[model samples]
Target: MVVQTTNNYNASSGELWPLLFNSKMDDKKPCYLLCGLPKPLECRLPDKQGGVGSTRECVSDKGTIQQRITEWVPGHKLSFQLVKTDLYFGPCVESIIEQFVITDNNQGGCQITRTTTFKAKGPLSLVVAIPMFIGLKAIHRYVFSNWKRLSH
Candidate 1:
C-alpha cells in the first residue's frame, strides 16, 4: 500500500529541501502526527552526514526507527528505506520506504511530492490498509503544512 501527497510552495526547492531534510530539530518544533503514534521526539543523522548509505534515527516515546538513505539528490529528491523499527506497527508492517521529490513549477516556485510505500505482513495487510493510508495521508499533510509555513 502507498499513500502519496503533493504540495506547492512559493519557495525554491533549495530553500525547502533543507527545511525538511537537514534542519536541526532544536530549531523547530517536534513532529507529531495523529494520535501520537509515530511522533518523532528527535531525528538525527550520524556524524552530520547526508547522502546515500547514511543512516538516520528517529526516536519517539514509542520506539526508534532507523532508516538508511537509498537515494539523495540535493534540492530535488531524497529517499530512504526503513532498516529497523520498534514501533507498535513493526510486526504488522514488513518494509517501508519513503521518498520526496521536488520539481520547479512555472510560477518560479516548486512542488514537493511525498510518497510512502508500505508492505504489510500476511492477512493483517488487508485489515490495516485503509487505516494506514488515512493515517499516512494525514501525516503527509501535517508535514506539508509545516513546510509551507517554514519555507516563507
Candidate 2:
C-alpha cells in the first residue's frame, strides 16, 4: 500500500477561506468541497445552524477536503483537518491537517498560504505517499481557481 499527496496555495488580497468561515447563507450552508462523487451534494461541513457539529464534513470520497474549522485566529490564520479519502481500503488514506495563513504581502495585497501535513494511521502509507501528496497539490490548484472565479 502507498499514499500520495500534494499541496500548495496561492497569494491573493481577500481570503476566501475566512469568507466561508463567516458566511451567513441559508442553513449556514458553507462553500463545500465538491466531491467528484455522483450524489446529493450535501457538502460535508459543520452544522453552524443545526445540531451537534462535528469536524466530519471536511472530507470527501473523491480525494478532497471540505467544511472544517479546527483552529481559527479570526483574520490571521486557520487550521483545517481533511478526512481520509479512501473509505474501503483496509489502510485507506491518511488524515491531513492544513494550516492557512493570511498576511500582508507588502505590495498592497495579502498572501494566502496553506501548509499541509499528513499523518498515516494504518496500512502501508509510504508506498504511494508521493502520489497522495501530488493529489493534494492538484486539489489546491482547483481551490485557487475557484477562489479566483469567486473573487471576480
Candidate 3:
C-alpha cells in the first residue's frame, strides 16, 4: 500500500531540501506521536555531505529504526528504504520505502511530493492498513508545514 502527499512552497527546492534532510527528526517533531506512537528521542541522519548509501537512525524509547539512502539527487529528489527496525510496528510491517521529489512550478515556487510504500507482514497486518495510511498522511502534512514555515 502507498500513501502520498504533496505541498507547494514559495521557495526553491534548493532552499527546502536542506530543511528536510539536514535536521534531526526530534526537531521536526515528526507526527508519529500523534498517531498514538511513542515520540522518537533522537533521529541521527548521516552528515549532509553523504549521498546514496548513507544511513539514518531514529531512536525512540520503543525501539530504533535504520534507513538506507537508495537515491539522492541533491535539490531534486531523495529516497530511502527501511533497512532494519526494532520498533513495535516492525512485527506488522514488512518493509517501507519513502521518496521525496521536488520540482519547480510555473509560479516561481516548488512542489514537493512525498510517497511512502508499505508492505504488510501478512493478511492479518491488513487490519491496520487504514490507520497506517491515516498516520502517514498526517506525518507528511506535518513535515510539509514545517518545511514551508522554515523556507521563508
Candidate 4:
C-alpha cells in the first residue's frame, strides 16, 4: 500500500526539505514523547552514509522495535525499513519511502510532496495494512503540525 500527499506548508521550497529531513524536534514536549516506546515516534536518522539494512533500535513500554535506513539519495529520496518484533503481530517487514521534491506551484509559494509506501508481510497484509496506514497517517500529521507550531 502506498500513500502520498503534497502540501504547500506555506514555506519556501529551498527551506522546507532540509527541515523535514533534519527534524528539529525539541524533546521536552508531549509530541516528542511519541518518538519513544510501544508506539513509534519520529525517526532519528543516521548522520553519515551507511550500507543496507543498518538497524536502529527503539525501546518502548511494550518492547523494543528496530528500524533501518535501507535506501537513500540524500534530500531527494529516503527509505526506512521497520523490523518486525515478537511484540507486534506476526512476521512482517514494513517501510516508508519519502521523497521531497520541489515544484513551482506557480502561485506565490512552492510545493513539498511526500510520498509514502507501505509494504507488508504474508497472507494477513490486507487486514493489517488498513490499521497500519491509520496509525502512520495520524503520526505523520501530528509531527507536521507540531513542526509548524515550533517554527512560529
**TM-score for every candidate vs. truth?**
0.85, 0.58, 0.83, 0.60
Give lDDT per model, in order.
0.78, 0.47, 0.78, 0.53
Per-residue lDDT of 102 in model 2:
69
**Model with the higher lDDT, candidate 2 or 4:** 4
Best by TM-score: 1
Model 1 — TM-score against the truth?
A: 0.85
For model 3, the stretches where C-alpha displacement exceeds 4 angstroms are: 24-35, 38-44, 58-63
Question: What digit string (tens of lDDT, one per residue) describes model 1 on residues 28-77?
Answer: 33334356546445567865778999997766667988899999899999
Better of 1 and 4 by lDDT: 1
Worst 10 residues of 2 by lDDT: 22-31
Better of 3 and 4 by TM-score: 3
Q: Which rank order by lDDT, best down to worst?
A: 1, 3, 4, 2
**Candidate 2 per-residue C-alpha lDDT over 100-130 given as tens digits, one digit per residue, 9 for 90 to 100:** 6767766655656667776555455665465
Ten-residue segment with the worst summed lDDT in candidate 1?
Answer: 24-33
Candidate 1 ranges beyond 4 A from true positions = 23-36
Tens digits of per-residue lDDT for model 4, 1-152:
86666665555555554455345444433344334323433444454333356554434344554557566554344455556555454255455454445565778656656566777677887887886666556545555665555444
Report the Cα lDDT for candidate 2: 0.47
- What lDDT would candidate 4 get against the real structure? 0.53
